[model samples]
Target: MSSLELCYPQLLNWSCRGLECLHSEAVLLYTLFSSIAVITVALNLLVIISISHFRHLQTPPNLLLLALAISDLLVGLLVMPVESMRIIESCWLLGDIMCSLSFFLSFTLTSASVGIIVLISIDRIVAINYPLQYINVCVCRVCVCVCVCWGCSFLYNGLILKDNFSLRDRHCNGECIVVNNYVSEAVDIVVTFIGPCSVIIVLYTRVFTVVVSQTHSMNSHITAGTGCKVKATKSQRKAAGILGIVILVYLFTFCPYYYPSLAGENNLQVLGIVTWLLYLNSCLNQLMYVFLYPWFKKAIKFIATLKILEQNSSHANML
Candidate 1:
């Protein structure tokens, strides 16, 4: 075999096999992943800034979004590049410790992202369904919940992949894999995917139902120059609709990643494609924000033009 066919030719038989890609394919994949990662970071950063810097934009729902953006931003910043290299090289060039760290980071971020989405769904439901008491859901409470989600994610992944910390357990010199026992993997899939996704879907469905009813109520009450409250209702409905789309897209991208757990087979090749597909969801998430939220676009303009750097800029009416 040619030296080029091995990830590290000098290691001879011990080297992991390299991915066979033509020059065009390599360029395309590199460009694609790099572009996605950059876009994901930039877009999510816009969200974080828009919500965090603007005092009025720091509502309970937006706080949840801020947390979600933070996780997504980390995905673009940390996980995508490593995963892309792992795919392109078809080998783990990083040592066992780095590999363990990579898996831990990836799992924690993905779990926290999903948890934040669930929180967002619940927030929307409460806002639309119980508008009078929505004020009761204060920013501090939301912040606490976000903290708990992140903490749990870190602890959960650490416990699940505890065995990976032992470098001697690694199967080969050029392979990076997280080994969870069958019971743990099963529980992880159910808790991470099945349970959270079910709650997300159910909450979104109820939120949409309430939104439709509110829309109809507003339509029946619309009168000459008294449509101000009605307009707010429409905005709420639109937010719900956009977030529903976000949840659907999240599920679509993530379903493949859990296919191994679903089929009860752990195939490395299949896991590679699906895990990247999962990471791509982070990139797509910010794009959804761009298309759905005018505030995001406005914030991007402000951020890009150095307007945000000005004193009292946080008071700008982004709504």
Candidate 2:
């Protein structure tokens, strides 16, 4: 009786309880998750500032990046803190309304991020395979694409989780769990993971194939005649490789969630750690920007030093 009372205080039948943990472990978890939340917010905010404030950085590719950065930033800002509390507590203390809203926002932001990356894959393919045609990708057109990506994400996720968003309890007490029928579960995985990932992979393959062909052609031309030059420059090829790494990192972080879905199991079963890994993609995207792009680094330096406050700062060369 005492043990039962210890495990289930108040004798409530439906309330969920978390696994017992030492106080030190709980404190350590809270600290670690808090630090991750801070880093995700700060890194994405840097990307947002770098791209938005600088005119020179306002190209089609960078515009796609800006949209991605915005999605990731919201993940850090709106999603991570609530997620951290849920993880640390291992229970939902927040009421039903908040739970549904939080999950809706989470689903929307994650889908938006994935959709932007799909657009990025296509953009990189065009840039690498057809440089002249790439310039035809106008800013207005890219803006339209971005809007479509976000709109699709909102609509798709809303349809999938429509039940949860209806201002009712999430069908659980002391738990914020997602429940889906067999068909919706399968549809969700196919649309969110398998479909987009397959497109990204195929697009990246075409890009790398073009890249290698261009590199070999350039090398042969250099051997034959010093004056001969290829359409794809050395620097552009390097940038393509670097950006490939960034996308690969995003895939590595995101693709693990597919496992539980594949196994036909509850996401909540392995969700705690997997979800955090997913959130870390938000930070890694910005960190890769800092590492790969010299212009981005310069922009960061300028902003950090407050030189951005000076007159005509936006006109300064970022590239």
Candidate 3:
């Protein structure tokens, strides 16, 4: 028996169960998880394609957005499908090899997504607090930072791949479970939760402070008839607001999942729900960009308009 069987013996109870009883419960949970995962994947793919195909949406900050979208898209397309299939099969039929691969890929992408968000918060902080400096630094620094995030997350996940595959249970599903080792648990907490959350808190704190300071400065300048200062202040506040929302979404979607997993509980039902919500975060990113950022909305609209015009021109040529 594996650690899960030791913890939750009821899951494998051979005495008080029928096939119907097991099938009904499994189907209900599978439907709920699979539907949500599929929708989340679809939405993330849409966001990735939209951003990738549109040159107008390819700024430095939006480059971070593209990275995030791609990471989440992988989680949806690769990780969630395996998870959903596991839920339906009621066992990890893919055996140990695919299990380790899936678990490592899922955790790496999830960590990288969080890291990218932290980088975005830092970028906004710099942009708001040091506008002239930001313009001078150029896109090369952004690329380097993104590459660092990817490399760090990849290495972190690679370190734990052995523990991920060491489980003795063939019935364990494809979802990421905490390894039964102190070092692995500690690393998971630091890499997946603590480090990212620390970055978020620090960067957002500085960002809010800068925004407040700029707002006050702009108000004073406005009193002296400086229109540019007012515009600058408004832009700073808008960026700050968007960052705040991103932080909230990250906390709400991710913390619940990591918190319980780190606690070493084997509550599969709770784990399933938290995992689904975390996947939903990928879909929510697009919605956040559409609702919070005016530039994103305008760029999307512009792309739509151009697409329409191109279609019309093609129709005219055919005629």
TM-score for candidate 1: 0.90
Q: Evaluated with TM-score, which candidate comes out highest?
A: 2
Candidate 3 Cα RMSD (Å): 6.0
Candidate 1 per-residue lDDT, tens place, 101-135, comes to 99999999999999998888888888888889997
Which stretches of candidate 3 lie above 4 Å from their native place? Answer: 1-31, 166-178, 298-319
lDDT of model 1 at position 259: 85
Worst 10 residues of 1 by lDDT: 1-10
TM-score of each: 0.90, 0.91, 0.81
The 10-residue segment with the lowest total lDDT in model 3: 12-21
The reply for model 1, stretches above 4 Å from the true place, is 1-24, 167-170, 217-229, 265-267
Candidate 2, poorest ten consecutive residues by summed lDDT: 1-10
Q: Please report the TM-score between candidate 3 and the true structure.
A: 0.81
RMSD of 2: 2.9
Q: How do the residues 54-114 of candidate 3 rate in per-residue lDDT, one tens digit apiece?
A: 5555568878887888888788778887777643443454556786787788778888998
